[model samples]
Target: MTELIAATGSPSWDMSRTREMVRARWGDKALEALRPVLRAVTTRLIHARIHFQDYQRLVSEHLRQPLEAGTPWWELMWVDEEKGIGASNYFFIAAEGYVYAGVQAQHAIADNLAHVLYYSLGWNVDQRIPLGKVSLGTVCAQLARETTNSPELAPIQQALDALSTAPAYQALADVTNHIKHHGGLPVRVGWGTSEQTPFEVLLSAFSRKQQTQPPREIAAFLEETYDAMSRAVVTTGLALNEWLESSVAPAPPDNSLHQDSTPGGQELHPTDQPARV
Candidate 1:
């Protein structure tokens, strides 16, 4: 069974985890290596927080629904009338910002982490096509192949191996792909015939301006998926950090990463080091 309860005492935007991700990806002396990417990731996550706060404010202030802190909104129908129209109206109006922000926050988290993962493995992530264009599994497979039969890359290989099988990582990869590539996320909630979890809002539900409940199992699945993703990110980060620190060999150099490599291009000059955090 999944751990239904959330892990304790972590903020939604875990700065400590953020630091860990960067530090672990590069060793202590190489903070310079992670500077630019960290700044970019931090900026994105901070924007996510702003969106989340705005969303929560709207939901708390205008909606009549009796919501418990941290409760997934899909459970409201089970607690009261089957998909109350009044509640749905309040939800649609008040929770719009929350839904949008929620999705954006998830995207930012996935995006930043994906970059870190790419960089940690000694890839010239700066030269590759945007990672969002590629799938997580493909990234892992490519890394595994690059690291094959090399003892120095063993730790990196181990981390990659675990990520290939991790449930949380897989869930995150699936959801991120769906949100970024598909029309939109599909959520199910139980009511007369439907239900929803706090994080899920069915695109179809809103499109029809009505409710459709699936089953508690589906809601639970969504909840578990998000929960797993949260845990998986930290796990992947720690493994990455370990890999970066443990590898005895120097990271592979790529000419493409040189600030001056792209002649006349907009890349930062070689003298302009990425600033320290």
Candidate 2:
């Protein structure tokens, strides 16, 4: 039952249950809370509204064929299981700078599809990325490499290149590690509330473009920002560990004695005592 969805432009059903689990984990309140975070991340990643629009256009073109053909893009990511407790499906739409997970069984497939469609078209866009086969990291790297020719991105590329020998890239190698290893660089102050959300971290890493000095200034900025983010991740990890320990520990049993007893031999506490004379 696997198929590629038109809007998402990727094979689905592989992670349907996983998607549901993520949605469940990020309940309605959490999801609503995440919007501001996502917006912040988007703002940091994109320098201008025009660039965002261009990115959206690129992704839109990729999805147009499937939509026009009336292909079932929604079904590609749907979970066929009758019961599941975790996220089993997930997909990314580069046109929109956010990922969607089916938290509830009743999430309107058509509506979700339409939302992604409109997002690709940039009808009401904020931020986006250019369509491509490579992962977002590779895309970002490519952008950095290409920008070596541009005045704006030249410093950014230089700074990033200097750090190629540093351990930062090792942590940033994968999505989870990047998020977990680098948490709160000023560039990525607010992206998502997830324990290891990396949107902001990546944005901060890319912000080396804003440095005023040449190679030295850019290098310093990259190192400082990476250090700051790595520290934040360490702090967050410690806090999370403490919270998990408290949550998983069992509560102590109640041991208070009753002060009053009923005529029927039922034990009653003093708070349930009759009025005093």
TM-scores, all candidates, are: 0.48, 0.19
Query: Model 2 — TM-score against the truth?
Result: 0.19
Best by lDDT: 1
Q: Write the per-residue lDDT of candidate 1 for residues 1-277, one digit (tens) a residue.
A: 1111233443233333333434445454334444455344444434444555565455454322444453444545334555565665565544444544444554555545555566555454354535456445556566667566655555545554565576644543444445466555443322232334333333332211133322223223334444444444545555555555555344443323333221111211111111110
Query: What are the C-alpha RMSDs, in order, of all predicted structures?
Result: 12.2, 26.3
Off by over 4 Å in 1: 1-33, 39-90, 93-96, 125-135, 151-226, 248-277
Q: Tell me the lDDT of candidate 1.
A: 0.44
Residue-wise C-alpha lDDT for candidate 2, range 1-277, written one tens digit per residue: 1211112232212222211222234333433332332232222212222333443353344333434465443432244666321222211233223211110101121122222222222322232333322232433365465566644434333433443434443333322233334442222112243434311212334223243211212123333433423232222223322332333325432223312111211110111111110
